[model samples]
Target: MCSEGKTTPKIVRGEGGYVLEDVPHLIDYLPDLPTYPNPLQDNPAYSVVNQYFVDVNDNVAQKIVVHKSSPRGMLFRRAGPHQRVCFESDEVHACIVTCGGLCPGLNTAIGEIVCGLYGMYVVRKVLGIEGGYRGFYSSNTTNLTQKSVNDIHKRGGTILCTSRGGHDTLKIVDSIEDRGINQVYIIGGDGTQKGASVIFEEIQRRGLKVAVAGIPKMIDNDIVVIDQSSGFDTAVEEAQRAINAAHVEAESIENGIGVVKLMGRYSGFIAMYATLASRDVDCCLIPGSPFRLEGKGELLEFIEKRLKENGHMVIVVAEGAGQDPTVESMRSVDHQDASGNKLLLDVGLWLSQKITDHFTRNKKMHINLKYIDPTYMIRAIPRNASDNIYCTLLAHSAIHGAMAGYTGFTVGPVNGRHAYIPFHRITGVQNVVVTDRMWARLLSSTNQPSFLSSKDVEDAKKGATDAAVGRGE
Candidate 1:
């Protein structure tokens, strides 16, 4: 039988599976659905939707009823007007918190956020969440005000205290929702930013109106988007200071050689920048450089020659410098330090040991190996003026971005310039090794060590050979 409405084939259940019967196409048979009346037709929500309609009250006397369905069904009535009433109160029961490793300018960032919100924005009820995400889930919080943040900017560590672990994003969101917090400012590194973004997304998904902002913080300065991470400049400055100290010690000790290791696990920016700043480093070993496991014997031979010829050696090695095999082996050994912290496989220490062993084999040579680890010292110093200013700008930019409803973003300086970039832009950006051009420039620079020269290598070999001959028994 032909269909009565439209002209197309429609599916019909038959004795078998299904059969196609003649029917109308969708466009020919479809009927329009009724439009729902807006609940806030007389309020701001009506204006926001920007729809034009005649008032039905005038026709009500005719005894007619209008039936319609909303996009959200009966729940459409709850989509109220976007009023500023929630933010009008003087008591802002909100808070700011920081978590993770100590990054430079952390305290300053926190202080600026609190002061900006409370003093300028007039948000008074501010609290600090201690121990990071843990503090968010745990029952640990401290009230903060303008006065409380005044001295905190000068501090190095976190004012609210910090813990490495605790609550996940959903848990923190649930806790904050329960506490009636309308907004939160999270100051932290990449991990913390990820957590904050997840929480923000979850809150939105749950239909809650809460704003969250993240300030980029990391000593590694590896966070993408910002020109530089918060603690990077400070770390570089501290490294330079330590390098300067090492140079002075080397000169004072007369014929003394010192090997100092700087922190830069996957990238050698710290070592490179420090080498550039400190003009006396004899040799700087960084990841991605020409120095590798295959070249270790040659490097040790070169170092011995430099010590014998110059009477003093100064080497700056990145903490991440070394061959993959040695580093991997060290990791497998599960070494631990006195503080219960995992003792990282230090490439500088390994290189130093190799040099020491090489010099020892040459009994005639009197070379002393002084290994100075500046990792802790560099990260613990007070932030320099440049870093503090940069961090303040980053924090301000982050807050402003949040206020503007930007999400999944990072604020920091890039290529020595202050800029903000999307977090997703660098979500999987690889940390490449230092390029060969940079390596060549560093090698040729008068400020850095010329230890790879032929003369230096020859002298080291001679020293080792002589020592071996003298040790003949």
Candidate 2:
């Protein structure tokens, strides 16, 4: 065998078939072999053959060098220890921003981040990106000093304004780069998180050094991994309170029927949790309740029949309940509030009318209909103690991860606790679909009537038949 330095080994035929001589050991042959360079290392092309040697012309060669493309003059070098120290100094600037609809604990999150970065990490200059992604691009920003964020911890809403149209990926990255922002903290739900991921990719593509972090903020509690979202507990508490009050009212009126409608576009966590908490809810109708259009009509007839037999009824309905086809369609035809969310009052009213009409025509019995909508009320109450503590812990974990150089992650509270996990690990966070297991668990934990029961099934089917004939009216 003939070996050449920095070249592939060659075999030569001799008088004795083939002669094996000057054969470099396998370990010594690696340095001369072609290999790719590390993209992150400085002068990576030149810093090749770290620990191995090569054989050249039947002799052992100590050093074998391979040349490749390199950065030309004026290109920024990989950060050195001193350079990194200066670049990540206390003077380095950053900002936090919120976007879209108002979620619970937004102020708490912002306050914690501002305090932790400035007071604990010595990151002094932090700006708040107002109006979300649109603000980032339109130069809508506000300086967040320690004093400005002090009283914000107790506040329920976002101190920095938010908007849905704020996040344009390219424009946001350009703004970040232009501002020399070293770090950015984005607070929102899935939409904001996706936007953050896009911005990170664009910045890395441009070879710019910046870090982005995300905090989950949606009252719907649709995000995975985190068992609970910032505003969910508060919303649930409010829902339960309203439900309990309605139950009392129904009991007080002596034979009066009360219907309370809640907000949960697709997932029934809010309705499920509230129903579980209020053991007196006679019938709970949520999206994941195994009720089809036929089943829904059956349910209304069952209520009318029950009211005729027992003089009183209480029903809880999720906003996503009934076969509405689509949430947008439901919202469009629905009587919405100022924020464009479907008004639970309208839903409750429609269902109540149906129940009243069914009983009046079928039994010639007049029934009183009381519709109660607890949508906004659920978002109005102060956060529960458990929720406040959980939100604070989640905030702390998020900031800790960020200071430790973690990225592409989300912090949340799960199963009455707090935990941090990578964003991609969440499976799917955008859609508003409910997991069957969760729905089943919520139903099992509640005292509500099960659709699978023989009596419920029979009553529901009879009601469906009556509604189909238009005789239930």
Candidate 3:
């Protein structure tokens, strides 16, 4: 029987032992009753955050349902007790792969997974799949151990390397079967998780029992339902240096406009937080909160007023902001990356030129503008202390999920707790900045003219309030 796009195979006892009752569901691996009962119950190392681990039969309360169309949710429960893995340590072959763009905590997350598998699980056949899915078919596998990854967390990039393409699900599943890979840990963003979910589906269709898990790696904090993705804190912290530079440039010159473009292809948390941290921003633009190019109480008017009042201005714009109006020229020749994200038009340069043209056309005061794009610098830095802890939690939770026979899920913090979120729930959505909640606060803090209309503000506030109520906060 198929329900919710997944095959629901019932277990039955046969001459060959427990087997899937449906003939169509016959696979190489069969589910067995969990043994080594209470394996970690008395383990000394289970002292810290032991509540995260749960018995396989222990159903949890507090189900968070999301997206009625997809109809997926997570049960908040303990996801740990390192000793109680689903696969036999000496027999299981586990592989890990990283995909998509680099994030600040990729290495930290990789290190935690390697250490947990080698040290905690004592898994003898731990392998790293290099360059993402492409590594599966190619001869790019590497042997991993706790000793090999001991200090990798102190670094920035993933030691396993990562890429975005080669999403051939059938071929990937074939490689998994050929390599005897029972557990796969995928570290990536939405696209990578989607790929993992597809691979899981293929494995299930072929009646294979390989477990696939994900740890979210979105630096923009755009993955839906996740409170914070890894690298956001570090990105925000590193963006501050750029913001400080912009502030100094603006302050030192007459009518200088320091324009900064930050990463946030679909969301604007980085730009919004950086603006708040700088505390000297005259105008801020984000993808979620679009502003008029030239109108009363719009972006240009606010910048002009700020220049007249303070003789200098600073503006922070998310890379995706004003796509409809400002990016028309760049869109004609735009290309997509292997992960399928569009090459974003240079919004910062476009905005700076607009400011210069406005001053030239109107014969207003001459303007000095500096545009800065600090995306690469921010992405290359090591994880901050806060993100380091977050990555560790996600990694540990992912390992727990995989060892417990859970698949097609991404480990993330939800409602301030680390939990398992089904990849289907986060497949095509983004956690955009809540205008009523965050943008309102930003506007008030900056004392800038209201860019959002009264009706829009009211709706945003209502949405925020309803979300808060749902969270019981």
Top model by lDDT, which number? Answer: 3
Whole-model Cα lDDT of every candidate shown, in order: 0.59, 0.59, 0.75
Candidate 3: tens digits of C-alpha lDDT, residues 208-238: 7678888889889887766777999999999
Model 1 per-residue lDDT tens digits across residues 221-283? 655433466788889888877777777777676567778888866567788777777778878
The TM-score that candidate 1 achieves is 0.70
In the range 328-374, model 2's lDDT, one tens digit per residue, is 33455556543233544345556666677666776666666678887
Of candidate 3, the 10-residue stretch with the lowest lDDT total is 17-26
TM-score of each: 0.70, 0.68, 0.85
Superposition TM-score, candidate 2 onto the true structure: 0.68
Task: At residue 315, give the lDDT of candidate 1.
Answer: 87
Q: Of the candidates shown, which would achieve the greatest TM-score relative to the real structure?
A: 3
Model 2 per-residue lDDT at 350: 62
